[model samples]
Target: MASPESRIIELASRIAANTKKLNDYLVANNLPTPSFDVKGPKANLVPKQEIEVQAARAAIIDDTQELRRLVLGPREYLMSYTHNELISQQAITRFGIAHSFPVGSEASFAEIATKTGLPETNVRQVIRHAINKDIFVEPRPGVVAHNAVSRLLAEDKVIHDWVGASTDDLWQSASQTCNALTKYPGSQEPNETGFALANNTKATVYEVFSQFPERARRFGNAMRSFTEGTGFELSHVVDNFPWGDLPQDGVVVDIGGSQGFVCFALAAQFPSLSFIVQDLEPVIRAAEKQPQAIELGTDRIKFMTHDFLTEQLVHGADVYFFRWILHNWSDKYCVRILRNLIPALKQGAKIVINDNVLPKPGVMSKWQEDRLRSMDLTMTELQNSHERELEDWAELFKLADPRFEFQGGELPKSANLWVLVAEWKGE
Candidate 1:
């Protein structure tokens, strides 16, 4: 076996090799080199179908993370890595520094301060910190301009909302998580979460957000950004699943499908299939107002207000789809959601779940695993819920009712979310 130093050197070599591969792919494809400059390529989004590019990118990410860990060593990393970066990011976002800067044109620190009503000294400090993270750039002595990352924050409303929700809402909730755990030990109630504690509200995050529509909208937009990002494309669901196998004019009920986005994608592909998108009254109403919803045709796709926890009213549907829903609730509520569906699930009806499935220890790349684990903790903080492992998902169906055939799951290639299916064998 090689020594740790030797292993690190090997990783460094791999990193360089992969980096060159990625660079070559980009150049050969006439893709612009990755840069923080505002004028850099707009196609910065993850390569969807480019197999070689994807492999190179993945190798680079994995090797780079390992190399950094080896260089820092365990002790040094733990001591040096602090929450200061998060705090600095929060300050920049809260002060609207990214929004203040022009995309192509540079602005002096003083001008940014004036636009954002932040102190010039403070603006310089926060902006410089963000610059260190390659978010914004200082073109000259004290002038600031939008980098590509900062330009996205400035121009993309959904990305802006993502930052706002992450730094403001999620950060506050995370800060109070420990206190919440101490206060409400073993609590499973969503209302007893860190979010509730941070806001000093008895209501759950959703309930509180309901009272503050703008905040709710921002959070929704943040989720939209997340779903649209990288491997979370709706096309993955349309292509990876057996939607084409369903009978003509078969009903697909979308439980908690906020804007019928998934349905919209499915409808476009499986033209013979119809859909019922069920959500809260306001969400359903909002879905109805969308031009895409109208174009899909009301007869083909209908939006209805229905609380999923109570009972699923649409009976004998070919498939009941839950996308990014069950993970928000603890196992108890997840079971309840399943049990509620039983009344409507006809024999052999499919219960399809599209969500994160936590990987076993050391199975995934460190960077990818870290994100999944963070999401698991986030579920805990927000709703006392957690991301389930494959076994946990299987067990959930078993616990819901034995009559339900708990089919195994698959993580589709090029998809962020796992697609788990269970068939109902009516009792």
Candidate 2:
């Protein structure tokens, strides 16, 4: 009998096939090919709406990763261990090396050192290390220029904030997570987290950020950066949910909605539905000045200064919405957040959530799974919270209140966040 095909060969074969398919699609659509050059596209040109083309691109990534792993073998893979991977990136963001020179111009190590106030030798070492990761390109023996990645660091404020937050906040917290866990075993308080430990404080990350506006803005923009990618698009929420089914005068109270970005999108799509966006005073103040909020505030969307953890104030709304919010809190706090809404919830009112839903293991590609799993760990590291499966969402509502009739949810195709709705069955 013929032996089963080897794993590496199978992966390589799949990689080649998918690569051809993706390339064909790109060429057919007049889309540019992927590149690390400064002029290259910042994102995959294959649109998420094109399922076949996007799947081909995704398969190529998964197969290539698997092929590399198989070729590495177990011992060699074990040899790849290290914890200092974020060091150069940390230096880059902390020192603002990406901004030390013009994107289109080349800079020598000494020149960058002069601009960023770093020792020339250290700048040379850090940038050379970053070069290996494609952050910048060394065009000559002593001079460097921007690649697409480093160009982004210099030009995209949100992306820069994301990198800075990931390096300065998340990486430090990650290193201390195990130590924090060991010290405070089974702790669920947000203050009892790696973030708290890293900051050498008992306060939670949010509490710490509240004391520093610039840092908080960076963190906020870091979160906002994800919305630019696939699945985080507001269009997914607008298109997937049945907002059209609401009564002509239906109201959606967006609990903890910062900047009302989601409500702005929803208000545009469903003119029949009005919105009340509630957040803390600072967030409300910021949202009130945003162009979208200014435009939408005319008749449909109203902004309110409130906090989700406090008693919910807006009463008898048709729908209450939470997007990218609940997963940041531990189950204890999530239950409380839901309970706070009970006083405001009308009979037959709906609590609709747009958030991450952990998939069953092996349900997604490794690339996708790694991202979700890392996010799960991050929630734990920062807030003692965790991503939930569909079952967990059902159980969470039931635990919150018996009247919160737990309804099953759906993850829209190619979208990262799921849409779950639970109806209040109050008599």
Candidate 2 on 344-425: residue-level lDDT in tens? 8889999999999998999877788889999999999999999999899999999999999978778887788999999999
For 1-427, candidate 1 gives per-residue lDDT tens digits of: 9898699889988888888888887788788888877887655534768877777787788888777878888898788677876766777667777778567888998898899998999888888888888878877899888888888877877777888899889988998999999999998899998999999998998889989998898998897777778889887788778998998889999999999989998988888999999999988888898999888778889999999889889989999999999999998999999999988878999999999999998887677788999999999989999999999999999999998898877888878899899999994
- Any idea what lDDT model 2 has? 0.88
User: For model 1, what is the alpha-carbon lDDT of residue 139?
Assistant: 78
Sequence-dependent TM-score of model 1: 0.92
Residue 200, candidate 1: C-alpha displacement in angstroms: 1.1
Tell me the lDDT of model 1 at 364. 72
Query: How well does candidate 1 match the true structure, expressed as C-alpha RMSD?
Result: 2.2
Clashing pairs in 1: none
RMSD of each: 2.2, 2.3
Residue pairs of candidate 2 with colliding backbone atoms: none
